[model samples]
Target chain A: MAILITPETKIIVQGITGDFGGRHAKLSLDYGTQVVAGVTPGKGGQFFEYGAHKVPIYNSVADAAKATGATVSVIFVPPPFAADAILECVDAGLDLAVAITEGIPIKDMIRVKRAMTGAKTRLVGPNCPGIVTPGTGKDSFGGCRIGIAPGYIHKKGHVGVVSRSGTLTYEAVFQLTSKNIGQTTCVGIGGDPVNGTNHLDVIKLFNADPETHGIILIGEIGGNAEVEAARWIKANCKKPVAGFIAGATAPAGRRMGHAGAIVGGAEDTAAAKIAVFKECGIEVAATPSDMADALLRAAKAKGVTLT
Target chain B: MNIHEYQAKALFEKFGVAVPKGTTATNPEAFVTALAALPEGPTMVKSQIHAGGRGKGTFTNGFKGGVKFCKTKADALAMAGNMLGQTLVTAQTGPVGRKVQTIYFTVASDIKKEYYLAILLDRATSRPVIVASTEGGMDIETVAHDTPEKLFKVLIDPAYGIADFQIRDLITKLGLAGAEAKNAAKLIRNLYTMFWETDAAMVEVNPLITTPTGEVLALDAKVSFDSNALYRHPEIVALRDLNEEDPKEIEASKYSLSYIALDGNIACLVNGAGLAMSTMDIIQHFGGTPANFLDVGGGASKDQVIAAFKIILGDPNVKGILVNIFGGIMDCNVIATGIVEAVKEVGLKLPLVVRLEGNNVVAGKATLAASGLALVAGDTMADAAQKIVKLVA
Candidate 1:
């Protein structure tokens, strides 16, 4: 079983009438994701057909979650209403919510995050590509072409991949696939300052997963999240892990789309993270390809071979 | 995203927090008039820039002589004329810097109470945290490090906002008592209100001082606005000071690309910030250097991509170029087309390596397929980085 989402999970599409939301809903439906409901506030009682199944639309997240019993919510609402939409989902008791929208006000996110602290609900991103479980189906807020990277790259193996960069995750998977390495799950933990599920959290999940033999962690510059995850991996993770920290050449003080990817001072550099991971005895890849190779090496070191 | 001190203080004042009366000055005459309007006493003239560390530099002391006690309009005018349009190079921003566009002239308060306070966006916690200390005026970073317990922090609940009890506790911890404590609490609440209303990423008041009359005054203000929220706040649009920012950064802003100037030799143009920073770090680790950190963003058009390339090449210190693109919604083929056009336009003789992956990788490779340009296309990020490092070396 995967960590958060699966094929049986009923999903609700927030801002379903909007261009971005509507487009991703169609793609998710095409990918065979169990999209049970859509919500666009004023456009309630409308219907969108996916295959033989017809999904009903609702006015609000609470209404949709009540009627459809949607466990997961993918939000495509614009930046302004992002926090409100997520809060509504959390209030509705939806197990997981992923906000595909970018440019959310930091204040609004802080409020959403504070509210989410004790709640059972889990939030993914205000700015991210969302998550995909390969052939079993995918639920992404951002546009990632289906079958772009062969589905065979993700076999139900014992290797799990967690990344801050969505594209890099795909790259790592592509490399692994070429090497005939498949994954139990590949999680794209969006690179937002106030994102839901960090590397440490994902590492904990991978550690607990019996199917996962090794894990590949992809990180970026800015926060000490990667360093913290490395410390956690050293202490808790029983499996061999290979890692790569992005943002090696990024200058300090520049934010690169991802709110979490900012280099305020010298200590937050990518090299510093690499040094930390190395000290923890986790093999560190200087580049993306090296990351995949390092993961393979770690698997070999642990005597877990892939045919 | 960073607004001037005057703009930050204006927002603070609107929320009922007392700030030193100040006006933004575009010219020497306006600067003089604004300074002359302040009450007769030793006035503090602060250079208004988005960056910190202004206090330790040339503009910190106001004029060439000691603290200029402006008794007459002429004295203020002389001070304004000298400071106006003059670049204040500080230890923080380095040489060749921000022009003194606004001079904050205010009455020096009688320091009965001084406290350092800031509401900053904490990345780790992904929340706005209120950091306050009783030992004020000096650097808050110093306070945070030395007497860590002395610095009381309160994580604000976004749904309910800064509670009344939290405000009272913060004031008490800041060594405030009685009516003065209440006033201080009110100021804290007002500051939090201002922080929300202005869509500020950071709002800091160093030395939130109390006068001999027990009046709370924000002696110094520092604010960083959310750039994405600038569309909503049109007033902040006027506060954009191009002179204070790097020319390349300013140019990249025009194309909506995120860029930060760094002191390195290799200019990097990556699709995303994480990759860009990683490339920079790798360059430094391999004994090479990076001149700038540029992220073309996700939805970059060919023109925008070309513009980003041009900006990177504009850096005089740039010895080589590294273009790393992991195409998501943005196609590598689209980026390659822009790179081809950019190389021709800029006539870049500097060694370059292009790492393009995802979304039509075959087509992306085909576009630049066999172009006799000195461009080396890498199949992966490692190859591209290693190639660039070797070429630069």
Candidate 2:
């Protein structure tokens, strides 16, 4: 019942010959993710061997898909070429592409996003921590984690987590796991000016998943996506959602860490978002440390037990 | 990255967008050279800073506004002198406004109507959008607040480009006729080109003016390019005004470290942008002010870590420093060594707290413990936050 990825999700790693890519490819294979192929131009037929698990290399995504039948893609290409990597995955008609690479020019994403409208592939992040869905019981089903998230932090459970921040997502999962509230899936939509997925898109998926009993939405200043998500949470999602917005004390115009995290105006501030969440029947966590507890209360309201 | 008005005007010209001829002046003393580029009659002595609301802003030397219209060269030069080096205080720029190092001396156009027009990324539609309003002089935020109906938005389909029908609809809505309608349409199209081509996050013309002869000109413009996309456009990068930014921010970019100077006491060093922000928010919540926001990033090297501490210690206001790392793709032992090496190199004068979690936590903790440095170790984010706050408080 996990959202996005699962035990059978065949994976392909883009920019596989690079240092980060090669290392993470090993890690993902070790974690039991179904990594079938690797892609790096001019380095085709190169074998990526780590312990007993060995994957074939292809020069192009189309070749990887044609031979290995890899349905999912995780891109680790550098910033300058990340956009083309994403478009390449889309051209190959991957079911989903998780872009682990950060700093892809927003204009490049501006084109990538428009290109994805009618395409078969659904892009995750150009600058994000990818998606993770822990396998239930002893890591049997390949425990679908696509990106560089610490594998130990996630635990298989009913709560689904979606966020724009990377380490903050880990922080929330840590809190949830500590409280014995495991996550069904966690997705980092990203922190760029232009991103692929949003709170509503993830929430819609989580709501339909029977295993996902609750959801945690982590937000920050600079955009009105949280507000729109709050309204959607009220109207559509029957499952209880707990939310946290960072940069409460952040000064206006200063970009606090993330690219999309600047207070635009009155409507885009943290307080305004908190108010909207509260108004939408969402139990809002005042701080990052309070998110897990707030989610517990929300789940309790919905009669779902954790711990 | 926000470019100055003159820089934006140059970009506008490059995209075939029409604007009033303007010349750039570095200092107020260079008014004679600036005025020489302008036609006779009336000219605007506009202060060049990163912020908006400059037309309504006041200078520290008791100058009325950042912008001034003058009929004579001496009057324009005098107005420019009062603002060139003085700090401006705008509604957007708090009490201490940015210093006006550059002045744009441009010929003023005869305004038949003032309109507000901008092309920006619409997050809802995931497309480039043009937001146009007949009400120009007022801030667009104000227009969105007071009369949202007066504002018109057209989502430009990336596949289709800007359509003639969309332009005609916008022109008809603006009550434009004859050559003015055609001119508005052309400017709208050019703005779209500039927005997508330059990878601009925002292309704002606050008061797009129409002359008596039915010509549309961008009277004022403020352009912000996507920081992520700056690599593709080196010319835009060259236009960056380093004097306008914090020296530490510029230095942080060199090491690929994401650091922002804040007015607080607890200097934070953490891994990941999300965790870094949460650290700041938690620090503030515990009644402790954060001195700065510094993220060494996901895959930080030992040298990058050392450089990060140097940048943090560069700020003398920092009373305490907190090192929080939730290692995922990053190894904890590497972070631990980075901390030890950074402290030894920089000579830690501030009370420091270190919190390391995930991937080789025990080895990381052992490394920090054996270092014999005066560092407060925390087992959790909550623990680290409380300890840093207590030390600073």
Candidate 3:
């Protein structure tokens, strides 16, 4: 079983009328996800036509959820309005909201995060690749595909993968799939400094899931989220976890691509985080290419069968 | 998004955070007029550059310091002459120093005591935090490491804002009483306002000093704004000093490409930030040095690829190129087509290794193969990185 999503998780698209949102909405439908509804404010009575699928549109998240029984939403709204779209999902009391939009202002996110104090809806990424629970069909086709992750690389199985990078997550998933290993779910928590979910939050879910036998945790430099997660894993988790931290060659204070991937202090550097991972009994990947193999080694050491 | 010291001080003044009376001049000829505003007592002349450690920094012309204190305004003027138009290299500026286009002149205050204060987002708490210390005018990192107790942090609740009690606690921590305490409280409030209202990434006041007359002032200001929020603050965007940025980086920004120059020989062009960074790591793992970090971003157009190629080739250190794309929403065929066009337009000479995966990857590989552009294709990221390293070697 997947940690967050499954084939039965019906979902809606927030900006389903825009080019990016519309394109991904069609792709998600094509992947056999339960894409039930669309939300585009003024485009209320319209429908998004994708092959045989014709999803109804609503003016608000609440309306879409009520009419279509959609529990999840994938936001593709622009940066200026992305925060509000997230808030709408929270207000609608949807089960989860996955924001695929990037470049949202930090201040907007700060307020959104504050407003989500005890909300029912779980927010995923504002600058993330979203979540993919691999299907049982050929090329992982029948499972839930939220946001923009390439669905074909996933294989339904026991190992859970979580990361702050999109392509990096794909890299790990591809490696695992190539080795005939499968995953329960692959989550990209995003690379923004103030994203909704983090490495620790996703790890807790993976730890609780009985089907997730082993996990691959990918992180980069910047905040202490990875270290925090590693410490938690050391204290409580018995599952074999393989970790990889990027930005070993990144200079101090210079942001390397990701807004959150800057070397702020000594604790958040690649070396410091890797040291923490080692001390926490995590099998750290020497390079990004070794993520899958590192997990395999960890599982073997723990005698945890991952296949 | 970092602003110069003078620009930060001006911003501080606008936010009611008092600073030393100062004036700036961009040339030696304007030094007389700029220093005329000061009362001719002990004055400080400082080079205007984005990086810190200016006081202890040395100029390329063998000048001793980027910042100097003079007994008279004439001495200040002379020091400004030595700094203006000269390149000042600091610990943070790397080997190639920034040219000091402007010099700041201020009336050096009689210091009664020094304290440190800053306002920035605490990533763990996800709130604004005020870091204060009695031990000022020194490296905060050193203070945090050696004497952790000396540092005082007030995590402000963004919902309720900074409370009066937190400010009072800070004032007591700094051992301030009466007039100085009152001044520090107001300064802290105003600083928070500036930080929130301006959407600042960080606002630091090193050596937040109290004068002999019990007046509190910001002696040094280091402020950076969030680039994503820059659209709302045109005034802050106006303060952007393009001279302080690499020309290639600035050009990359124009085309929505994320590029950071490095000191290696193999340049990498990839899609997505996380993949770009790991691409660098994989290259290094294979005993190769990456010359630059370039993320053409998701959904890169054909023009962006050409623009990215031009920017990468601009660096003379680059000997070969690696293009790694694990496309999700970003189609790999588009990237492959762009690479072909970029190579043809730029008249390629260097060995290029391309690795394409996910979302029409087969078509992407076919596009590269059909181009007849003399490029090598790898099956995976590791294979591609290894191939480029060997070719470049």
Candidate 4:
């Protein structure tokens, strides 16, 4: 049982006819995610083909959900319409909407986020690597993946990982897989300034999961999110948590690819966040390799073995 | 994503928020024309730069103010002339200040009470928030540090918007009255509308003023639109003043590389933004200053990798280079091939440290080794940092 998404979850692709959407759809299918349907406006009654697998395309999320029982929505819509697509998915009552689309405007996301209040649907990212529950072989029944991070790097294990950076998630997971310490779930919450899920949100879910023996959090500069999440960990988190913060050497006020990657204040700096993580009595990881060692140590402390 | 004060004012006007009538002047002649359009008496000459604190900042040529209260048209023209070609070093702008290419000329307002107001995303609430204080003429940061109680914030409900009643706290705290309070509430609502419609990340009206004539005005404007949402507003994109930006950054943007120049000796080139940042951090953690932050992105092409190297090497301050690539969406060999190509094309001669992982690592390392470019190989990110720092030291 994974923390956010599982192998059993069926996904519908939003903007599936576009290049990014279409290509990632193929990748997700190859990774064995249950990508059952696609949404492209006025492209209804058509099919998006990735070899013999022809995923049905719908004009709206409503039609696809009605036909395929796709509980999860994997959005690759352009930034302008991405927020509306997420809102449409939420209104359509999808259990989870993973937005791989980066650069959705903050104000637009603000509206989508507001609409999510008390709503049943959970959102992962508007700019993110998405979530993956990697278990066994590359088959629909063996694993779960929702973002653009390379799928083959992940392996099923005990550590639950959440990160704000997409490629770093793959790096951390690859290191874990190399070391024979797999994961319960790997979630890249995204690098946008305003995103749906955060470190604390994923941590809360991981904390409640019995299968996740330890947790690895990858935070970055800009925003006091890591600090806030560390405070939460210090107070109530029951699981062992290892943390890695990016942007430690990042200059202030530089929007580093991700919108939210700037250092807004002193406390949002990597040094500051690492200090907070230390104060929380958590294992601190500086690099991707450091993350693997820290995570395995945490799991060992939690009475688990990698081999 | 940041716009000039005049550009911000243009946005304010579009959103029904009142502001001082101002026109942008790019030349001394335009400055004279804009000054003549103003009512009378003193006019405000503001240097149009992205960073804040222009009123207190000094010019690089030893002039006192980036902002000037010009009593005559000749004075306004002279001030504009003094600013347009020179750099203004504000507290926000480092020692090497930004060159002023435009000046905003506005009619000075009659101020009764100076207040502070800004609308930005409150990450904690995950909602747009309006922060206000009556102590406005000074820095909001100073306000936050000194009198925390004076600062008040209201999270706008996206569904319902900022209700008139929701602004009651600001009104009460600032001692606003029937008309001023009512008008201020309406102003807040309009600002929220602007924030929503423009896909703005932040809109700050420092020294939001109340005139002796019983009117509220945005005395100064600072607005930043979300770069991700720039597609939605091409007009805003058109307002981009590239002259104010770093040439290296501009070039990097053209190649879709996330590059920022820093004052250091070691240039870093990495794949993912997070990894790039962490690589920079480890360099600093190991007592080495990074020259720049360059992210070649996840699926970078060979050309982009070459361009990234060119940009990093463009800065003569860079004495060494560190290439850390963690291949997931990116293949390690692609980076290695690009590095080899860039070295041959540019006659590269810097102490380089290469750390490669993920997809096709062996081939990437093999490619780098075959190039015979005097590159030191590191097994881990930390090891790479230590090696690069040692070489530079």
* Residue pairs with backbone atoms closer than 3 Å in model 3 (clashes): none
Interface RMSD of each: 4.5, 3.6, 3.2, 3.7
Best by DockQ: 3
* Candidate models: Cα lDDT each: 0.74, 0.85, 0.91, 0.83
DockQ (0 to 1) for model 4 = 0.50
**Candidate 1, residues B298-318: lDDT per residue as tens digits?**
778999988988888778888
Candidate fnat values, all: 0.52, 0.57, 0.64, 0.66
Q: Please give me the total number of clashing residue pairs in predicted model 2.
A: 0
lDDT of 2 by residue, B261-304 (tens): 88898999998877788788889888899888888998899998
Q: Can you tell me which runs of candidate 3 are displaced by over 4 Å?
A: A256-265
Summarize candidate 3's per-residue lDDT along A63-98 as a digit string, tens digits: 999998999999999999999999999999999999
True contacts kept of 3: 0.64
Candidate 2 at A13: error in angstroms?
0.7
Q: What is the TM-score of each candidate against the true structure?
A: 0.88, 0.95, 0.98, 0.93
RMSD of each: 4.2, 2.5, 1.7, 3.0
* Runs off by more than 4 Å, candidate 1: A8-10, A15-70, A136-156, A255-281, A304-307, B59-76, B123-125, B345-348, B370-372
Point to the candidate with the largest lDDT: 3
Q: Which runs in model 2 stand beyond 4 Å of their true positions?
A: A136-141, A256-267, B27-29
What's candidate 1's DockQ score? 0.43
lDDT tens digits by residue: candidate 2, A1-307:
8899886789999988899898888878877888899999998988888899778999999999999988999999999989899999999998999999988876678778988888978999868899998876453235887888877777888899999988889888988888878889999998876788888889889999998989999988767888888899899888879999987766666752111221233557888999999999999987777889999899889887654
